[model samples]
Target: MAIRNCLVTGAGSGIGAAVAELLSGQGHRVALAGRREEPLRELSARLPGPSLVLPTDVTRPEDIESMFAACEESWGPVEVLVHSAGAGDSARLESTTDTMWDRQLELNLTAPFRCVRRAVPAMRKAGFGRIVVVASVASKVGAPYVSAYTAAKHGVLGLVRSAAAELADTGVTVNAVCPGYVDTPMTDRSVASIAAHTGRDADGIRAKLAAAQPIGRLILPGEVAAVIGLLVQEEALNGQSLMVDGGSVQS
Candidate 1:
């Protein structure tokens, strides 16, 4: 297999970092872009393959644009884009401020759209590309206290499907991976927040989330990355939402 020129957003931590590491291990030319530089640099150092540490704020359009430009300059046109920079918050409808809702959409949905926008022209010109958006289980099923997050993820799924359909004739593929309760820093904070609010131990809260999945364990970050890896190589799975939610979602 050719070593793809890949760009992973949120590569400083969690699923993003895991994806970057996994791809780099497979000898891909990976660029790590995130809000923090230190972790990106640290992860880059750990990789056997060469990597670019691009500190980027995905929510800022200018930053996102510059990050991709820098990535292309360093590694060539990104043949694969893993949009892993996202966040989810627990806020019931009544308590979900408009600002919070807008920001969630900005980071989780709009950012990926913009990234894809910049990536596709090059991808089309080159004739091969793979784009994966890291969505959440909230995109498929509804949960309380995360209406805004659910809405944003839902939007991302829509974008994936629509874009995939548009590019079906092209060599590029667009897809999404929806994972449930992954054992990442985001889930750690979620567990802690629920524990503090409900007077339960964080471990107990984490266990509950794990139990909600049929597999009865927190999803591993590598598990999600492996799915992305498969999609990047796959020729037939375009426009799909591959679920890595421990069998909680079937379809």
Candidate 2:
């Protein structure tokens, strides 16, 4: 296996953190990017090898450019780019404000676009790169009260597929990992929202969500990270949206 210079966005927590840590452990030089500087610094300090912490807001083009520049300066050009920065919003169409929709789209869809756009030049130059977009199960299944998030994720899948096709013959691969309910801080917030909306206890709501999945539990962050690790392998997997939803949606 090659020692990749990897850049993982939203690496301060959840699946992003797991992916960054795992890649770092595997002897890859990883650059952690996120809004929270403290967590990114802490993760960098704990990881093996030289890990760079680029505290950045993915929604900003300048910030994205700065992060990639810093990564390149510290660890050379990024051979692996994992776009795991996203946010979910729970709101019905009638209740969702234009601002909320725009915000979600900016963070969930356009942020990845910016990152990918910035990475493509370097990747093409190297002629060997791996790109992974972290989408969601909502991309496949339309869930209620999350129209904006679902729409953004669907767009992400489309973007990944298009990029994959464009780079098929090149030594680069573009793919997406669509995860179901992962047990992360975001899941906790979702549980709280459900409880508040339905007047149920947090544990009860969590139980209901778990039972909704075929596996009878929320997916772990490490589980999703494992799928990401597999996607970056030097194989023929391209333009595929691999679901890590524990049999939630069979696609």
Candidate 3:
């Protein structure tokens, strides 16, 4: 395998951290971008190959620009882009405030769009690039609450599909990995939030989330990372949303 220059957002923990480990272990040069410098620095220390720890908030356009500029300066153009920076919030549509809606769209939808726009021209010029979005089962289907999050995810999926088609002939493939309830810190937060609101035991809420997956357990971060590794290596799999939910939502 070629040692590509890869950039991954949300690299402090969860899916992004897993992807960083997998790609770096394979000897790729990785640029880790996240809001926290300490975690990214720690992850960079443990990576097997070359890496840059960039403290960035993807929601800010200036921060995104600086991230890419730094990557270009350190390495060359990014050969692989893994956008795993996202968050989930649960609230009924009626109760969801404008701030909540905007935050969801900014982080989950618009941020990736900006990153893709910034990365694609260089990718098209290189004539070989991979863009993978770590989406969620919420990207494909709906739930009772989490309306804002679901909407943002669904919109991002649409973005992935449209961009994949547009860049299909440029040797740049765009795809998504939509996993169900993954065992990550994000899910932990979700469980805590639900417990606080409903006055239920956190463990029970977590158990319920696990059972929602067809496999009767939460998906592992490494499992999702493996799928991302596949997407990054394969050039034929464009405009595809590979579901990693253990047979849930077989689309």
**How high is each candidate's TM-score?**
0.98, 0.98, 0.99
Q: In candidate 2, what are the lDDT values of residues 1-251, reduced to their tens digit? A: 78999999999999999999889888999999999999999898899877888999999888998999898887789899999988888877899999989999999999999898889888888789999999999889898999999999999999999999998877889999999988998889998887787788999888888877799999999999999999999559999999998898998
Evaluated against the true structure, the overall lDDT of model 2 is: 0.91
Q: Candidate 3 has which clashing residue pairs, if any? A: none
Cα lDDT for residue 206, candidate 1: 86
C-alpha RMSD for every candidate: 0.9, 1.0, 0.7
* Winning model by TM-score: 3
- What does the lDDT read for residue 85 in candidate 1? 96
Model 3 lDDT tens row, 1-251:
78999999999999999999999999999999999999999999999899999999999999999999999999999999999999988887799999999999999999999999999999999899999999899999999889999999999999999999999999999999999999999999999999988999999999999998889999999999999999898888999999999888898
Order of the predicted models by lDDT, top scorer first: 3, 1, 2
lDDT of all predictions, in order shown? 0.92, 0.91, 0.95
Model 1 per-residue lDDT tens digits across residues 76-160: 8999999999988786689999999999999999999999999999999988999999999988988999999999999999999
Off by over 4 Å in 2: none
Model 2 steric clash pairs: none
